[model samples]
Target: GFVYAVTTADLYIRGGLANRVLVIGSETFSRILDWSDRSTCVLFGDGAGAMVLEAGEGAGSIADHGVLAASLRSDGAHKDKLFVDGGPSTTGTVGHLRMEGREVFKHAVGMITDVIEATFSAAGITAEDLDWFVPHQANKRIIDASAKKLGIAEQKVVVTVDLHGNTSAASVPLALSVAVADGRIKKGDLVLIEAMGGGFTWGAVLVRW
Candidate 1:
């Protein structure tokens, strides 16, 4: 699945879904930053990375399968509040990401949590049974709150926002690669990946790697 701003002039694009979704949360804020504007620039960076997840055999529950469950959600009402101003017809130009940070923050927390819980229920797993919880690397505050609400330890979560900022579609897989390469994620371990983007689009992928 892909996450982008449909409310803005930017055209959305996505590719076919393969057998597996490694899941990631990468950002490239620096590449799109107005460096002079510290409020936004200071919150970004640029990079790309990816993860690898193959099909596995399991009984039925999350404990039985590679990716036993996941959830997706959206809300169109707040579209304009956190989107770019220009589009092909309006200004014949692509506008930068304009957001009411705090506003987006509120929706993000609730949505992320909602998806996570749904994923667990669908998979027949409990939050306590999760080995890792990975969320979009949007902000530290949102990350911390989601973890707390889910009763997950802060150390069990993966974060790349400070370095990658908000690489959009690239974030999740990139962080997964980091964890695996660093020996943090191991084979047969359970990982829950979730994200919320401008479309108000969000989803969760629970997998075993």
Candidate 2:
């Protein structure tokens, strides 16, 4: 999938695959030393995106298909929790990614669990069946809470937020590449991907190697 949007990090990226509803989080604002009175650059920097999901089977069971099932959800009430103020009409520009970090973090944890649960229920699976549980790598604490809520094994989660610093949609696939290179996500393994972002959009995807 290819899209045009002013990234919170001010990056211009186009085109990529959406494997299930992989969750990739962006926390670009955390790097800002000052969260107040920076008219030049508001709380922009953090943003995230997920892959465009497509279904395919290869003589695979829930453990064989590239993606078995997925779910998505969002709430408008939290719209202001995180957002950019500028737009094409206002400044003839893409605004910065401003947000209430604490608030969004709170909502993220709860919503993430909901999305994963929905995926599991729809797929008729359980946490025990998951080989890898990757969440939007926005905050370590958030990742911990969501995984814990879903009863996912600690060993099954892969974290790339530290190195990538939340490339938004790029996070999930980037980490997948890492695990693939490291020989962690072997063929036929069940992988779960999830993420939450600006529009309060969030979802999960279940895939098999």
| lDDT tens readout by residue for model 2, 97-148 | 5677888887888888988898899889999988898776667789988889
> Model 2, residue 164: displacement in angstroms?
1.4
**Which runs in model 1 stand beyond 4 Å of their true positions?**
1-32, 52-58, 88-94
Clash totals, every prediction: 14, 14
User: How many clashing pairs does model 2 include?
Assistant: 14
- Could you give me the TM-score of model 1 versus the true structure? 0.79
The reply for model 2, stretches above 4 Å from the true place, is 1-61, 88-94
- Which residue window of length 10 is worst by lDDT in model 2? 1-10
lDDT of 1 by residue, 50-156 (tens): 54444444565545645455577777888875665564344334556666777888788788888888888887878888888777777889989999988888889
